[model samples]
Target: MTNEKVDVVIVGAGASGSVYASVLAKAGKKVVLLESGPDWQLTDLISSEIWGRRVKPAGAPILLEGKNPMAYAAQGGWGVGGAALHYYANFPRLLPTDFRMKSEHGRGHDWPIAYEDVAPFYDKVAREIGVSGDARAEEKWRPAGEAYPMPPMKTFRNGNIWLKAFEASGIPMVPAPVGMNSVEFKGRPACLYDGWCHVGCPIGALANPQVTYLGEARKAGAEVRAWSTVTRVLTNPAGTRVTGVEYYDDKHQKQTQEASVVLLAAWSAQNPRLLLNSATDKHPKGLGNASGLVGHFMMSHHVASTWAMFDEDVQNHMGTIAVQYMSYERYPKKSHDGAFGSSFVTAGFAVKTTDLANSRADLYGPELADYMKRAARNLAGIKTFGEEQPNVENRVELASEKDEFGMPLGRLIHSFDSDAVALWNANFEEGLNVARASGAKEAWSARGTMPTSHLLGGTIMGTSAANSVVNSYGQSHELPNLWVAGPGIFPTEGASNPTFTIFALSQRGAERMASQWGTLTN
Candidate 1:
């Protein structure tokens, strides 16, 4: 085995890891970012949907199928850019009430930090990442912050239809702020409105990691090693601090890297998995499981959606990946039932030819061609993505089976709570009503098994070590030098895409780590 040393070691070069690396490197820290996936760039993203399916990690086969069925339908980008490469650039902030869930509605745990505490960080992140929207329109519930960097993307025909329905229903339909560029900013070109963002943005108009933080971090002298699968965090005989990580390189050879501090920035599932796998005589349950809560409190956004076929050509397919909509009215506090409110967006962009085929197949294949022919005439679909209360039962644990690498794989155990189900039902009924109001021949509600891109809550944070795995600053209570930077540190899953919050927390953690680097020792 080969060994090397660095000031800081970060695992997983996804959204949070990339941001952490950028901030630390800019602060003049020597950093090494290890990614299990290969390094990929915008130029590597092919424009075709078929090519997109072939874009999984070089050697990590899709682990969601067969005997080791995934606990949830998890989908994320694999590579140095991580899942941000395939993320739809919806950059909405969690409402103020989302922070104090337990105090406000008597549900789930509250965040250790409030909206006010994180608001400045949010504003800074938004400006740095270049969000585009009218902040004034979202002022009702969105936490106070600086205005968006650019004007909202132009409303397409389908967006206009949703706006009309929203107005008629007394539900606000303000522009949804997005990460897609509306105008040239920070040297990146404006969005082409091509509707292929879910696959990946090849033109750098969207703020994926490759086009934003990772690209900047590389230029700032951070070293990113892809295809480096970390197996365990090595520590001194005392087990009081992390010394380095033992990993399997691309060639399946073992190696170790020494570091003064270690940051676990992997996604929700993998973050807890790694911690659980790092057990020793001192931490038999897990590295930081003194409270026995390393992989508990798993949460995912509850999703509900409805599609309508309209007589008018609503341009069913065209425009940016995300088109338009509103979410302020759905703030959790407004419902008064202690249930989280629902957020809706109009999927007005053109459905790719492949999506059209798949949607037809999903509805039954006999009328497939006819459905495609009438797709343009139908125009719009409303999708509601909401927050779920954190339930300890819904968790990530290790199964008896092992992965191809002979390491125990993650077993996800999750289910929606009564509150989540109530919100989902209400949103579904509301969406159907809106579709009917929009002059639809038929309105169909879809509630497929709730899968989400916004993964949150596992190695949660709290004011005290007894209540959470990590402290407010993301430093583990049991292991001082081992920190976490990702959505996995969230105590609550607010109804917003997690990228912005992830960036903010990572910046905060990196700042804290950089200032206290001298105190942390291997």
Candidate 2:
């Protein structure tokens, strides 16, 4: 087996890991980033959904089970940029109440840290990432923070129609906080508004990891080794400190890279999967699984769609995808009324004829073409996002089967609580009302689908080792030298998208690591 060493060895080159690598390397630390996928360049990205599929995780097969199986392929990525390459960049911060869910609403579990603890990092990350938004427009309920780096993106006809409907319905809608550049900043060009975000941003207008922190990390002397699939985190005999990580290199050969500190910023699934698979006699469950909670508390957002056919052509495909506008009329804990969790609605996108045809299933050649023509000119869609409460029963487990690499595969099982279901129903109805209020001849609700990208919990952070795998700083309670970054440390799923919070926490975690480096290594 090949052997190498570094001061810090990071697994995954996604949004969180890239940020940590950038920070640590800039601090003059010897850093090595191991990514399971191939290294991607900005030029490699294209504006085709089919091509975008190639970027998703292909390291191993994962078994998904539950009423709503995790949309693994759509939610994960394999290249150096990780899943952020295909993200829509809807960057909304977590509400203050989101952190104290259990204490404030007596519903979900509480986070070990509070919103104030992470707000500065939020500001720092937003400025670094070049967010475009109007804090004042986000309404009086928005948590305090610096104004967005750039003004909000110009709203198109779709947003105008959506705003009118929201006003008619007495729902508050605001310019979406997006990570795409409204005006050129940091040498990256302004967005073309080509409306291909789901397919990945071909240009550098969007702040995907490849164009942002990965480049910063490289400039700071961090080395990124792509096509390295880490199978386990090795530890010392006492199992109280991380020794290194074991992985399969590009040639499918076994390799070991020793490090003083090991950071796992792989997404929620793989982070816990690697941790659980690293079990040893000293730590019988897993490296950081002393509480037997390595792969528990899985959470995902509930999403439903409402579509309407307007008399006028809306050109819904003209602007950014999933980054136009958002309505937070129902996003606060105190405003829930009878609904159990926070929820919000965002403007949706134009549809392809084939997709609409598939949805219509019964139509033939002529009828399908006719409906497609009408939908192409007149259709408008909106999607609702609702928070999920953490449940122990919703988890990721090791499957009986093994992958081609001979590692135990991940099995995801999740089910929404009754309250979550109620919240989704309420949001779905509201979506219909918003559409109808927009003066649609017809409006209908589509069954809610779970977003694979926003998955949280599993290896959650908490107050102590008795009930948590990591502390608030993402430090393992069992292994001091091991740290977990990203949404995996989240205690509960907040209603807003998790990308901004992930960046903020990663920044905080990186600073914490840099501050403790001398003492920990010595």
The TM-score leader among the candidates is 2
* Residues 1-522, model 2: lDDT tens digits: 856678999999999999999999999999999998889877777767677677877867778888767776866778798888878788888878888998987876788899899989988988897999887788476666789899988777756777788888777778889889999989998988767776678678889987888889999999999988899999988776889999989998989999999999888988988988888999888878879888899998888667777888787667777558887778875454567888867884545444455435556889988978787767777877898888898888788788767789988887887777788888878888888888889788766364444788898999988888899889999788899999999998778888989999999999999998876786
What are the RMSD figures for all models against the true structure? Answer: 2.5, 1.8
lDDT of 1 by residue, 1-522 (tens): 856688889999988898888888888888899988778867778877778764444443323422213333224667777777877777777767777878887777788888887778778877887888889888876656789889998777767777767778777777888888989889999988778787788888888888788887888889998889987888778888888888888887888988888899878878888899999998899888898888888777766667777778777566766656656566554552545544544445556776565443466565776777887556467777776777787777777677657678777766776777777777788788888887778777775655454668889998777889998778998888999978889988777777778888887777788788777762
Kindly report which residue stretches of model 1 are placed more than 4 angstroms away from their true locations once superposed: 56-74, 334-347, 357-362, 451-453
Model 1 residue 86 distance off true place after TM-score fit, in angstroms: 1.1
Candidate 1: which pairs clash? 77-83, 193-319, 310-378, 317-350, 318-350
Each prediction's whole-model lDDT (CA) = 0.76, 0.83
Q: Whole-model lDDT for model 1 versus the true structure?
A: 0.76
Error of 2 at 222 (Å): 1.0
* Whole-structure CA lDDT of model 2: 0.83
